[model samples]
Target: MIKFSGRGLLLDIEGTTASVAFVYDVMFPFVRRELDAYLQAAWKTPALEPVLRYIAQDAGADTFAAWTQDDATEQAKQQRVSAEITRLMDNDIKATGLKQLQGLIWKSGFDSGELVAAVFDDVPPALVRWNEAGKDVRIYSSGSVAAQKMFFGHTNHGDLLASFRGHYDTTTGPKKEAASYRVIASDYGCDASEILFLSDIVAELDAAREAGMQTGLCYRVGNAPVENGNGHPGIESFDQVSIG
Candidate 1:
């Protein structure tokens, strides 16, 4: 029954509001299955050229400006892009470019009714309670801000985007760094002590604590049965939290 009084609620997605399995099983597999075809179909357009450039930059293929500029014939270029994208996915690199591309792919899946974002049962009600109480709720995750919105906006509970104040991603800073939490606190124009941060990762909770925010570790059913070895408060669900 650990409790903290704060006007701002900060949340981590994976292993917190949503099951990590949904990400690893549904989202990652969807991107892997669809990326090559999507790239092949989109290469001719100006819209995808910039995205390809970002992917190529991360792949270390510096001279591969875009699909249109690849040295080989178009067929070979498709093969190269597909291979590079596959290699990155296989390695599970959390590169910003790859994440952005995955989010784009997921947008298609969500729009086509092939994918539905998952949220824990306790989450939506907690979000609504917090909003009604006038507490500012924000998301901070490794997923890009756009991806985070897409996820919340399409969850089974219906659009939860209106419940959020804003979002943060790795672009703001690394999750395990205290400076990042400080930045978010500053961005919200509040003292870190006024924010309560919830995540499944101990290091992230440690970072948030260092930033002067209250912290909790989410211990969902699918997560490891590890003890709260880091001394942070442990919660099994949002039902255990209160903003007001």
Candidate 2:
């Protein structure tokens, strides 16, 4: 067991508790392949306008507005959005607006039993163990809060949402920035030192550490390999972690 002292646990999703392959291989492809279909289906839905607007805004107001002009058919708008979303995915930019919109689209897939989240076998148990021990557990993923909840709700281990206190996404601010961890600590009404952050990325751990939070580098099998663990205690399983 790894020695730790903290009041709560902070977690990264992809490459931490879940397989990176699930995100890069499965989720990204699913979103890319289904983007056009989802856009076409939601074309007339008023709720979809905000998501479309964000896509346009991110792409370029003048160009996208021209694409959305009166003479431009719904199909043209969708084609543009789909192409732009594909570009974002290819570049792997974590845009808040795009992330939320993708969460909405993924919701449909989850509801239809078409998508299932692949959680590590050790995650659910460790979550329960830590939570039961009175340690608060929460997630901080690049994915939206809704998307995080969706994945946990549909995980192979069954509903694990109850094991978490809250979720954080890019909306909280960029993960590689120390200020974001400070903000999260303030929001949680705790000192940064009270939270232990677990992630597969050294830069993220470095950020958390800079904010005075304890950090651990998760080195799970099939996760993207790291050249060095940056001197943080490495965890192969959530079982290795303890917040006490």
Candidate 3:
């Protein structure tokens, strides 16, 4: 059984609290398919420029050049940007643009019935129980905070975003890095010992443990470990957890 001694619960998406295949199959494919169109439409949007700048910087291209107006060379730039984006995605950098773009792209798939956010049947009840017990419940995912909101707000489960107290994204830090967990603990204004972090990935749980938080691995049905020698405790359902 997994134990929670914390004053709050910090859960991960795309594997721990949610289905991994849902993200890789539903979310990632949509991003890959519509990325070009999204960039074309959002090139001039004020909120998205920083993400463009990040792309330019990563590609070693000039960031000062105005990308608002597509020129003859725009396609070349987009190709380079696409390549750089692939690298960032492979490395799992929590770029805001990547997350925002994913949210926009996934929006279409979700609306078109191509995809739906998949949460385990037991998640909502456990979340409600956590809330009723006066324990804060938060989300920590590689997905941007906005994307996280959209996923929960429009899941097959329906509008479960209200069950959470807060959301965190890669902006908090790289999920694999221990310092990020420290930052999360600070953000929650609670001792790390009082925070339970649940995830399916051992590396993330290791980082959280280093930050002094408790951890549980949510081995949801149909999901299997991708790595060897993951020694952390694992859970098949939220029903297995005893949260006090």
**Scored by CA lDDT, what does every candidate get?**
0.84, 0.84, 0.78
* Candidate 2 per-residue lDDT over residues 192-238, each given as its tens digit: 99889999999999999999998999888897779988888898998
For model 2, the superposed segments whose C-alpha errors exceed 4 Å read 44-46, 60-71
Query: Which of candidates 1 and 3 reaches a greater lDDT?
Result: 1
The global Cα lDDT (0 to 1) of model 3 is 0.78
The digit string of per-residue lDDT tens for model 3 on 111-206 reads: 776676889889999988889888989999878787888888878888899999899987778898889999988988999989988888888999
Model 2 residue pairs with clashes: none
> Per-residue CA lDDT of candidate 1, range 80-198, in tens?
77777677779866666677677777888888878888999999998888888888899999887888999998998998899999999877888999999999999989899999999
What is the TM-score ranking, best to worst?
A: 2, 1, 3
Per-candidate RMSD, Å: 2.5, 2.2, 3.0
Alpha carbon deviation, residue 127, candidate 1 (Å): 0.4
